[model samples]
Target: MTDLHKHDRVNPLRLPVVAVQGLWLRSTLRLASAPGGGTSGTAPGPTGPPLRLAVLGDSTAAGCGVTGDDEAFAAGFAQEVATRTRRPVDWQVVGQFGATARRVRFRLVPRLDDDLDTVVLLAGANDVLAGRGPSLWREDLTGILADLSHITHQVVVAGIPPFGLFPSIPATLGRYLGERADALNAVSREVCGRNPRTTTFIGSPAGTPPAGFFSTDRFHPSAQGYRFWANDVAARLLPAQPDA
Candidate 1:
């Protein structure tokens, strides 16, 4: 059959399959558009040539507290990557605000591209915030990381940041959250240690957290928070690019 077909109002692949780089991934498909024209599909396009980044995590990565889509970690991260690499960047945000590692393994992990160069993972806080045991949270994060190893050779495990100090939650609960964050970060660091392509970074509140970084909710990081995350992520990314 013809991979190339006229995608009109009736058939959207009307957009020609322009060959980019060595791979022929459908531009329209990448652009989140259907083969048929005159419609909105999830057709995402490449920034420069063909690069894929996957950012998966909880509310922070999903930009729940952030005012606009640009404020989201995924969007901000992509923008930072574009600036750093001086090329257009396309990253697919595959995270639910309260997602756990188990959910990512079964749901988000399956949707990733086989040739993904980098996979940034975040979780654990939600697991603990939900009152789940830290041991189970460790297993979930490790299992998900192991699963990602099959597809992405490079994985960046951002240790769960410290949020307990924030004024948003109760002091008692904040203490509990802080302790769990430490525990889960330990687990994540261990997992990263064992992987050849993995690296871990400690993201705690004590660092240079930008003013207004926290969203209005005072719970999640604001646009500034994501901007900081992007810079931090880029630092980790620089080292991995040579190996990737």
Candidate 2:
């Protein structure tokens, strides 16, 4: 982390700007939460050996703003992989709203087992929201990845999205938060890149999100948005398939 005085001196308007942003965020955005945790399901498809997959992280991993567990990122990704490979997919989600990297590492990882073939981690947004520094973010994420490696050789870590691109947040605040998110993502990529045996960074789609991609709350992704996320992850995992 950079020197605090340096950052403060550089961005003199940051405090007031952040204050305005906080007020705007509180007033405009809906308080959305991820629904139905410890979620599990099977994706129906042609007969074949089943692939056990697990998704763990924060709200996005929990499928907040989506109606059912089937519509969540984990389920959507599992279903697509199952359909494409003509294999049965047994998938589960263990996630919660407002979960940070440290929280997920300490709270959720212990509950998982080593039976999973793959694990997808969707996190860091909450860390950015809480103003966590890049170093702390890297430490917690590294620990999480290490714990996950014991359970599965394959782990996909989703890069943090552009928080400033969300429509609900004020532009100034969005820019500030976006910079922080970018810093966190850089840490994630560096950590994953160094651990080829266990971790791979699958980035979120870049650029400003299109209209209707966000849910009614304008914070979490809509179902259509989740589909896009699932598709991206599925594509990465598909290359590992025997058929590919």
Best candidate (score: lDDT): 2
lDDT tens digits, residues 1-244, model 2? 1121223334766868776667667666675784733388888878778988898999888888788667778888998889778889898888889989999999988877677888999998888877677889989988998888788868998888887788888887777777777888888889999977777887778666666788888888888888887887788757645653
- Misplaced by over 4 Å in model 1 are 1-48, 199-202, 205-208, 239-244
Q: 99-135 in candidate 1: lDDT tens per residue?
A: 7677777887787767776677867666655555557
Which residue runs of candidate 2 sit more than 4 Å off their true CA positions?
1-10, 34-38, 240-244
Global lDDT of each candidate? 0.59, 0.80
Evaluate model 2: give its TM-score: 0.89
Residues forming the 10-long window of minimal summed lDDT in candidate 2: 1-10
Whole-structure CA lDDT of model 2: 0.80
